[model samples]
Target: MKYLADVTTIEYNADKCTGCGRCIEVCPHGVFDMNGKKAFITDKDLCMECGACANNCEFEAISVDYGVGCAAAVINSMISGGEPACGCSGDDGGSSSGACC
Candidate 1:
């Protein structure tokens, strides 16, 4: 399931990257790619602004406009008496993640 990703606010400051590859590890959309020792934004539009990469980066190298998308899902789930999910169907045909959408 693809989220309606528009122009994202995701930004990558390579100078701040510690070469830990944390951003590379957490981006669900493969938005970040390693340029040898540092990471750069390979595709900004691929980002859903889920904040997963930003949340995991201890070095503060990656930044995204958070508190939307998944946050909206959380609020909607609460209002609708449902659970927050990533919308990815598991092998058993169920939601795979309750967080990090």
Candidate 2:
């Protein structure tokens, strides 16, 4: 399902973006589009926090807050009685169990 409107944590830096289209090619949800030579965020909410775009972006133009949005993460958090986290587990040691919401 779609997340809350305008709640996207993805940030795109035009200066850092080389218009290489890597983000466009890697994003499964079509969250990005080509605006001439620049990349644009067409549907930020479509992001599932999978980190695919960020991982594929060599320029590091995309930044996200990183939240738990996967079913495995949610189930693991519930079973562990801990805050669900992005697959990365956060830098703070997974103290907060909030979803991508």
The lDDT of each candidate is 0.73, 0.79
Best by TM-score: 2
Model 1 clashing residue pairs (backbone): none
Task: Please give, for residues 1-101, the per-residue lDDT of candidate 1 as tens digits.
Answer: 45555678878888899888888888778888888898888767778878999999999888887644565456556665666554434454343245444
Off by over 4 Å in 1: 1-6, 70-101
Q: Tell me the tens digit of each residue's lDDT in model 2 across 18-100.
A: 99999989888899999999999988889877778888899899987666676766776887787665554656444345444
Clashing pairs in 2: 83-97, 84-97
Report model 2's TM-score to 2 decimal places.
0.67
Worst 10 residues of 1 by lDDT: 88-97
**Clashes (candidate 1):** 0
